[model samples]
Target: MTPEQVMNIAYQGMRVTLLLGGPLLITALATGLLVSLFQAATQINEMTLSFIPKILAVFAVLVLTGPWLLKLITNYTIELFSNIPAMIT
Candidate 1:
């Protein structure tokens, strides 16, 4: 494969990875921020306080977006596999 083809594949892989992970990461970040704010307001300095909320938020996002995420990855895999023969020669 040419350098350009390799780069394209790598770029696509990264894009897909980001797309798949972005939601969970963002959800965690938002949940953490909200929990921190709540802790500050209530004077609760427990580090573990944020953990459960972040986990629950991320889990909720994963559950809500699971089907779309699955379809996205499946489509990308199918496309990549379909292009393998072309990439080989």
Candidate 2:
């Protein structure tokens, strides 16, 4: 494969990775921020206080988005695999 083709594939892989991970990361970030704000407002400074909510939020996000995320990744993988023979020659 040419350098350009390799780079293109790498770029696509990164894009796919980011797309797959973006929601969970964003959810965690938002949850953490909200938890922090709540802690500040209520003066409850327990270190573990943030863990459960963030976990639940991420879990909920995963539950909600899992199928769509799976379909997206599966389609990308199928497309990449389908092009393998062409890429080889």
Candidate 3:
């Protein structure tokens, strides 16, 4: 495979990875921040509060977006696998 083809494959793989992971991570981060703020305001500094909220929010997001996420991943995988012969040449 040429350098250009290799870079293209790497770039596409990275894009797929980020797309798959970004939403869940972003939701978790937002949930954590909101929970932290709430805990601070209420003076309820429970050490585990933030973690639970983040986990729940991330799980909820995954459930809601699962089909779409799966479709995207499947498409990316098919595209990559289909290109194997072209890439090798």
Candidate 2 lowest-lDDT run of ten:
1-10
lDDT of 2 by residue, 1-89 (tens): 89999999999999999999999999999999999999999999999999999999999999999999999899999999999998999
lDDT, each prediction: 0.95, 0.97, 0.90
TM-score of 1: 0.95
* Candidate 3 error regions (>4 Å): none
Query: Which ranges in model 1 have alpha carbons more than 4 Å from their true place?
Result: none
Write down the TM-score of every candidate. Answer: 0.95, 0.96, 0.94
Candidate 1 deviation (Cα RMSD): 0.8
The sequence of per-residue lDDT tens digits that candidate 1 reaches over residues 1-89 is 89999999999999999999999999999999999999989999999999999989999999999999999999999999999999999
What clash pairs does model 3 have?
Answer: none
Candidate 2 C-alpha error for residue 83, in Å: 0.9
Please give the RMSD to the true structure for each candidate, in Å.
Answer: 0.8, 0.7, 0.9
lDDT of 3 by residue, 1-89 (tens): 89999899889889989989999999988998899889889999798879878888899999999999999999999998998888877
TM-score-wise, the better of 1 and 2 is 2
Colliding pairs, model 2: none
Instruction: Work out candidate 2's RMSD over C-alphas.
Output: 0.7
